[model samples]
Each structure stands twice: as C-alpha cells, then as structure tokens.
Target: MNLTTTAKPIVIIGAGIAGVHAAETLRNEGYEGRIVLVDRDTQLPYDRPPLSKEFILGELSEADISLRSNESLTALRIELKLGVEIVSIDAKKKIAISSDDEILEWEKLLLTTGSSLRKLQVKGSDLEGIHYLKTLSDAKAIRQKLDGIQQVAIVGAGFIGAELASSFKKQGKEVTILERMPLPLAHILGEEMGEYFLQLHQSEGVHVITEDAVVQFDGTTQVEKALTEKGRIIPCQAVIVGIGVIPNTFLSDKELHVDRGYIVNEFGETSLPNVYAAGDCAMWPYRGDNIHIEHWDHAVNHGKCVAKNLLGGEPISYTAIPYFWSDQYDHRIQYFGHTKNWDSAVLQGNMEDKQFTYFYLNESGVIDAALLVNQPKNALAVRRLIKQQQSVDSDLLSNPEVNLKNVHVQENEDKVSY
Candidate 1:
C-alpha cells in the first residue's frame, strides 16, 4: 500500500479511475516523483457506472461524476494533459510518442487505456440514434436524446444493458432488453441464476426479450426501430448496445503481447520491462485462466498493486478475488470468484422469495463462486469460502436454521463485506 521512490518521470496513460487513483496512491505512499497524466478525453476522470443509473435518472449531474476537483488536481502538483492520445510506446527506448508528436521518455510507464464498448455488428449501427455508454460524452448524448422518449431498446443482458434497462424503467420509459442467449447473464451467473434475473427484470415491468438478436435497425437517416432476428419490430427512438467491451490497445504492438487486451503477469508486468498494464486493458491470470476484468473495482485495485511493483516494492502478486456488482431497479446483484469449475451448488434462501445467495461449490466442496440478490451480507462469508478452500457442508449453507456465524466456510468467517 506504500511506495516511495525518487524516480524521474512516471507517465500514466488514460486518466481513468485506475490511472488517477494510482497517481494518488503513489503520492500517498510518500513518492515525490513527477507524475504526468495523459488522457484522450477533454474532461478529467469520472465514474462511468452512474452514467446509466443515477446520472440518467437525474439524481446526479455531470460535475458529480468528476473524481477530483480542479483545486485537488492543481494542489497535487501533477501534470494533467487532457484531450491527448498516446500514439505508441517504445519500450526499449522507454519513451511514449503522443498524437501531438511530443515524445516523453519515462522511467516507468503505466498503461491504463481501459476498454471500448462493443458495437452492434448489425445494419444501421452507425445511425445517429444508436448509442453506447462508455464515456461521459456517451452519457451526455443519451441524456440529451431521452427527452420525452417513450421506448428504449437495450441490446445485451449484461451488467451495462441491465442497469440501463433499470434506469430507463425508473424514468417511465418503455424499456425492452434483447439478448441473444436463451438465458440472461448466463455466461456470468449461469443459466439458472440468469433466468432469475430475467424474472427480476420482468417483475420490474421491463420487457425482457431473450433468444433474440437485433438483426438491423430500421430508419431512413436515423434509427426509428429495431429489427430482431425473430422478425419482430420494436419501436424506439434510441438503441443502446451494452454487449460488453473490447480492450483499447491500438497504441501497443506485439512487443507487449497484446491479445484482446495487454497480457500481464500476476504482478501486472508486461513482456517489456519498465512497462506495466492494469485495468480493463490488461489480461491477468484468473482461476487458472488469463482473463481481463472490465469491472471498475478490479481496475482500481489492480492499479494499486501494479504501482507497488513499479516502486521497487517486495514481489507481491496481484491476486485479489474477482468481484462485480450490478444495480438494477431496486435489486443489486454481486458475484464473486469463479463458477466455471463448480460441480455443484448450494442454494441459500428462496429464489421465489426474491432474496437469496446461490453459492457454486466445486467437487472438492469448496465454494468457488457466489451470486447474491437483494441480500448483500452473504458475500462476506462466501468470499471467505472461495479464498480458504474450505469444505462446505451443504446443510450449513442451505439450512435457514443453521447459523453461518459459527460456521467457517472460508479462511475467515469474521471478514465483512467490502
């Protein structure tokens, strides 16, 4: 958590939450080095999740999204370069070439370019009325178009699409979500729990359409309707695609082993020395799989761990349990750890009751992954189970009479929710 070094110019690309926080953490760690922050956006780093939720709901404004005030940025004595893009990185030369044709050599480079929203590969996708939420400008565009809008079609049933549907429904918009999979959130939460989400959205009065692909958009000059694979037409003034995201790595070449995202080790180190990648753009090992996490918390935490490595700290591997959450309507869904390797599941509480935690247990009886709906407290013990590799008794997990407080499912049951 502490980094103190006299390194000459630490350059951070993409002023996102990860980049900004890493810089802040560096200063907190007593490091008095020069931190130059570069970003392609005109505005400073802001929260992206609220853009589809509270921001669109009118509970928060654009300014509320800013992570730090002008005073804070100025007082930090950090160089802020906004609306600038990094053209490429010469790792061997330890220099970063900017779009404006300025090359700055860095003692250490932190790449945090983040992810780009995946676009619908359908016709009329380039139309004016279609949008995706990935940046402040994107959120602004959608908010402007939402004036008196009646119907909104959201493509994909992932976190972003689901959250948007919830927000749109709250704003009295006729929200319809279309998913190509038979079950919503199947790849993330599994089909059983994905259907539960389908029911959850349906109960909230949102039209949940599954097993349907948006074939094309219908309009002359702008998007007026959505043409589904089922040959059904849904009237809409706007369409938001939230299928997922692709890593933004146009600047880096194979010298860093860039796949969809930059490939990194357990400590967030890339193939090139003195260069580290974090957040959505870096792929690290997850449950024996080299995966890229797109969640905000993961990005922030990864930034901290990577900063430690860059500051000449002890060899600490970046190995936090992967976790993600989604706020849809009045319900909040949070998942932790891996589920793909689980052979069995222990269900606690009633899905019909709409408040329960489903824990996926591996053949070894250790809780591998968990999905919690409405109940936020369950993630506390479940995360423990995942870390400790403890053998779970199905009765203790599923039985309402059984006290989980006395039972240690993970390494430590006393650990609380984050």
Candidate 2:
C-alpha cells in the first residue's frame, strides 16, 4: 500500500525501543496516517540498556532515557493503548482483538514485543527480595531496596549481570558474582578480555566466584543464601537474576518461523506478508555467521529499515555492522561483530592498566571479531573489518607497533546472512 495515498493506520504491538522508533520513523518518513501503539507496559517507551547501568547507578533517571516526549506524540498523533494484552490475531482479517474486546485494524503490523528475562527454576525463585532488571518497575524496585542492603548475590555474569554488579558495588553493597562459566564473558568477549573484566570487578572490591553452580537456595520466604556446587553457602539479603532474556514470541503462530527470536527476512518481513517484526524480539540476517543479536543499536537500525521498506521504496537489504556497548566497574566495554570459533586472540596494551583491545581472528588470520575495553575510538575501526569480513596481516594485527588508525575496511557489497 502506498502511504501517500489513502492508507490504513500502522499498528505497533509494542512500546519498546523498536516499536517506539518504528512509529516515530513512520512520521519522519512523512506517513500521515494515524499510528496506534499497543503495549503491555503502562509507562511510555523508554531505553532498556540504561535501566541496568546508569539508571541503577543513580546517574540517569527514568525520564532522561525516553526517546519521545509528550510534545512529539502530540505532533505525530500517536494513539497509545497501555496495559492491554493482545488476546488473538486474525491476520487474514487484518484485525487484532485485545483482552478488553478492543479490536484494532491496520494496513500493517509491527511486532516489537521485545524479550523477558529467563527465570531461574531453583528453590526460593519466587522470593520477594529477588529481582531482574528488564522493565522500568523492576529497576525502580531494585533501586529502592538497594540502599538498605549491603550484600547482594548476582547470578549469570553477562552484560546485565555484570553491570548490576558494578552498580551495586558503587552503592556500597558487597556484590558477589556467581557465574557458571570458567571465565567471565567468554562467549562474546573471549578469554583474554573476559579475564581482564574479572580482574576489573575484583580490583573494585567486588567478589568474583567462577565455575560454580547454584545447587540450591537457603531461605524460608525470601532469598537469604545460595548453596554452591562446591559446598559454599554464601549469605545474601537480595538477589538479581541476569541469566539473559528470551524473545517474547509466545504470541507468534506457526507461520512466523520462531527461533530464539521471531525470524524475519532482509526487509524485516516475517514468513507472513504485510507483517513485520524488529528489535530484541526479532532476528534477521547477520553476516555469513547465522548469528542474532539483541543489541540496542541493532534494534534501532532494524526498525528504521522496516519503516523505509514499508514506505514503498524499492527495498535495499540491510547489513548492519554489529556494535554493542556495556558499562561495568567504571570501564566502558564495546564489542563489534559475531565471533564464531576464533582460532587466535591478539591483545594490544596492558590489562593491568585497565586499557586494551582484543582481536578475535580465524586460523587464516582474518579479523572475525574485536572488543575494546576503555578504547572507544578503536571500536569504530574493528567494526569495519568484521562487517567487511576482510583479511588482516597477522603480523601487523598482533604487533604492538602497528597503529589501529591505519586500518581500512574493505568496501565489498556485503549481503545480509540468516
């Protein structure tokens, strides 16, 4: 449907970073049709990445992270239906029925429902003091309770888990990280970078426990202690589970091709036509890696691509150079690209000084992925090599004498891979 002519209003089924930007992009792209936003959250669309870091650290507020203002929504004529759950979908009829019998019709539907944190199924899982930083309310409750507590046990040492550890330590809480992995953040950042991260947290007075499994929780009602596989019972007043989030695709039907995330094509079109998906909830082509990321930048770029494609423009496939950032223990960690089975890792600079870049390369000496801790400018260059899938001189990439600025990204026409 050409939006310039008479077009049915676009219906967005989320108020997350993906849905919010998708609706906002439609207006910026000059679509005058009414925009209807359906969300399960009562608060308006706000950034989620900051919730675990800056918001918990007492640096940024809930209002500061919002992408759109009341003025912006007023000028755009966006209709918000908050605290409503979509009951069922009749895609053939182009109509969605909600729990309140509020049926919505649309020319197109964008599913940006995002994700939910994976809950630990152990005992004391439903304890009151336990929390997960996925929503605004979750952050608020955790922040309110943090002041009274001095000891905290965090499970899963991923970005969210590590950031929470950093934030709590700043609040004078004794943070203990319980990670099942031998090295912290090994999957994405590799061993060298992960080791540096482990030291960084420990140097800041945070206790680090590795290769330990939580066999059980010892508490009557609230989580008071966690028993480890090594037979260590650690005392704690509060617990935060950061095991990671699973894409909210429970509402998707068989035609949608749901994996960990809703599978979409290059244009953000699902298996069904006229139905698009984006953000943390959606997965598109990565390079030749068959990888998927839930990064903030990826969500924003994918939403914009969907908006442009919906505008009736001859769709150009989107190939994003994956870039993501994290803040932990006063260090800014930025990573680029998907590293699949790297054969060698080359490090530049000193880890003890808290500044370095680690390059993940294949056996043939091509830079598949790279991560920078406290090196912001180097992140941009590393992103280029990984995106282009270009080869690098192993001698130069490993040598400390070579300048990273001399690196040039190959300009091949890269295709989006699923």
Candidate 3:
C-alpha cells in the first residue's frame, strides 16, 4: 500500500509532539500529499515536559511552549481536526471512524495517540480537589487552584509527584508525598539511589511518606484530608495523583496487535498494511524485544522515523537510544539506554558530593544503561558507547580521573551474555 499511488490523505491520529512532528517531517521529505492531523485536544499542540516543571512554577506559558508556530502547520498545508475523537479504524477499508460518525479514508495512517493518566481506584477518588497532571488543561487547573493552599498531599513519588513537590515547596507550600513504595523511584533507580532521592526531597523541605496507601479521600464538597490504610489521616486542601499512565490503545482492534500498547515493527508499522504507530501509544522493537517508551525524545525520534518510512523510501529501523531526564529542585538527572534487569551497577564519582554516574551492566559485563547526575558530558559519552554497543573498562568507568571517551571497546573484547 504505497501512499504515492493513492488519493486518500495521510491521516495522523494525534496532534501531540509525535503526530505534529510526523506531519512536519513528511512535508520536509518532499511529501506533497494530503495530510490530516487529528487530536482530541482543542488547543494547538504544545510541549508536555514543561507542564510538570517550568509551567507549574509559572516560568513558562502555553504560548511559550507551543510545539509549532501559528503559521507553521498552515505553511506545511497540513489540515487539523482538533477536539475530535477517533472511534475505530477499518484497516481493510483504510478508513478511520470518528466519534461523530465522520469517516476519514487514509492512504496511510499513523497512530501517535499517546497515553492517558492512570486513575486511582480508591474510594472517594472522584473528589473535586484531586488532580491528575497530564495535559495542558490539567496543569492550568492545578495552577489556578494552587494559590493559598497551605497543606497539599501528593500521591505517588514518581517524576510527576516529585516535580510537583519541588514546585510547591519552592512556593513555601507544605507538600506531603505519599508513596506505596519503600522509597521514591525504587523500582527504576534501585533502593540505594531511591533513598538518596528521598533524602534529597527531605532536604528540600518536602515531607515524604513511604510504604503508605491512601485508602480514601475524606471531605464533603472538596478534598479536606486523605485517610490512609495505616490508620493515619493526612490533612490537606488538595491532592495530586501521579502514580503512572496507561497507553491509549483503545482504537487498536484484533487486526492491530495490542498488548500494553499497539505493537509495531522496527519500521514503526503495525501488523495491518498502511497502518503505523509511534510515541507512547506504540510498543516498538527495542534490542531483541518489544518495549514501549514514554519519553519526549523517543516520541520525537519515533515520529521522524515513521515519517521517513511512511514516505515509501528505504525502511529505517527505529533503533535510536532512548533518553530521559528529570529536573527536581536543583538536581539534574539524565539517563541513557534501556534495561529491566542488570547484573551489577558500577558507580563513578562521589555520590556524597551529589555528582556521580551509575552504569548498569548486563550479565556479559556490557553496559546496558547509564545514568548521570549533573554530568552532561559523561551522559553523552555513555550514550555514544551504548549506541556503539561497545564494552568499556570497568576500572576506568569507576575512576573519576579517567575520561569516559577514552574507554573504547575492541570488536573481540565484547561478549554476549545469552
């Protein structure tokens, strides 16, 4: 199903960074076809990373973070159908059915539908003051209601929860973070680093409650307090739930292989022909297995890759290294690569000085992932090494005097664990 021979539009079922970038990339690749960008959001596509950071701090506005300029989409001749929900996709007919019974036939379809915030299933979860920050409107609502709020309770201690804690604490608002885990980011960063993060939050004057669950919200009209399972009551005027997000895979039918997200090949194409998926909604091939990444850089690169492949040229495998960063208080934590399991993690520099790089090694002693705190240069070098799939000297990696760029791997020096 080459799009060049068809008259139907190349429809993108999202208007976020990924979808918008795909449309722009298509135009940049000399694709002069009908491109339609559909999104459930009415506002112009804006940057999402700032929503939990600068936006919450009142340092950035929606206009300042707009992904594309006002005339950019029009200049590219891309049609936008904002605030419209896509009901389903007919792969055989190459058409998308909208919620309003509108049919859109497509020469090629890209699903960058993204993800939705995971809702808490506890009692009184539907209370008025409970907030979930995901979209721009969600941020706006939080900002509007945050003024004069003395005691605020934050559920979950992930990225969003931690960032919100920092933001609120900066404003001198008393913030209490309730986490079900023993420590913040325990599963990802390991318990040691998680403890460091916990200490970091405490140093910032943010109260941390670990291994506690909010059983219910206790209030009449608005949330006044949270009742914990441990027989404790956390008094607060507002609550922010930031446990996690679930991929928006509702549109994926039997024809489209769906697990946690829409399954895609190396080229970002789904099982059905002329159908593609990317961003947070797409579970793509990574290394030897399929993984879904919900990061800004991954989504942008995914969109670009899908655009090139959808242009009917040589298929480009979307195997770019995944990167993610988190900004809390004054600490900048940057991570490169992907790994669920690692044999050991070698630490470089001084963790006591709050400046260090940790390398996660596979069973074969090859670096699968590396994270650096306030060390951008080391992060870049590690990213390069990981992309090259090269092994490094563990001694030099642990030695602060040794430069990471000098640690190179010969072809024979690398070995596979399995």
lDDT of 2: 0.80
lDDT (tens digit, per residue) of candidate 2 on 178-254: 99998888777767667877888888888889999787777888788988989988899898888888888866666
User: Compared to the true structure, candidate 3 yields what TM-score?
Assistant: 0.97
Q: Score every model by TM-score.
A: 0.94, 0.93, 0.97
- How accurate locally is residue 107 in candidate 3, as Cα lDDT from 0 to 100? 88
Question: Residue-wise lDDT of candidate 3 within 1-418, one digit each (tens)?
Answer: 2347457989999999899999999988888889999998899999999998899889998899889875888999999989899999999988999999999999899999999988898888888889999999999999989888899999999988998898898889999999999999979878778998999999988889999999999888899999998988999999999989999988967778998999999999998998999899999988998998899999999999998899886799888999999898988989899998888889998888888999888876678898889898787678877887755557767888878876666656463221
**Which lDDT tens digits does candidate 1 get at residues 135-206?**
888888899998788989999988888889988888889999999998888886777887788888899898
Q: On a 0 to 1 TM-score scale, where does candidate 2 land against the true structure?
A: 0.93
Give each model's clash number: 2, 0, 0
Worst window of 10 by summed lDDT in candidate 1 = 409-418
Which candidate's lDDT is highest?
A: 3
- Which residue pairs collide, candidate 3? none
* lDDT value for model 3: 0.89
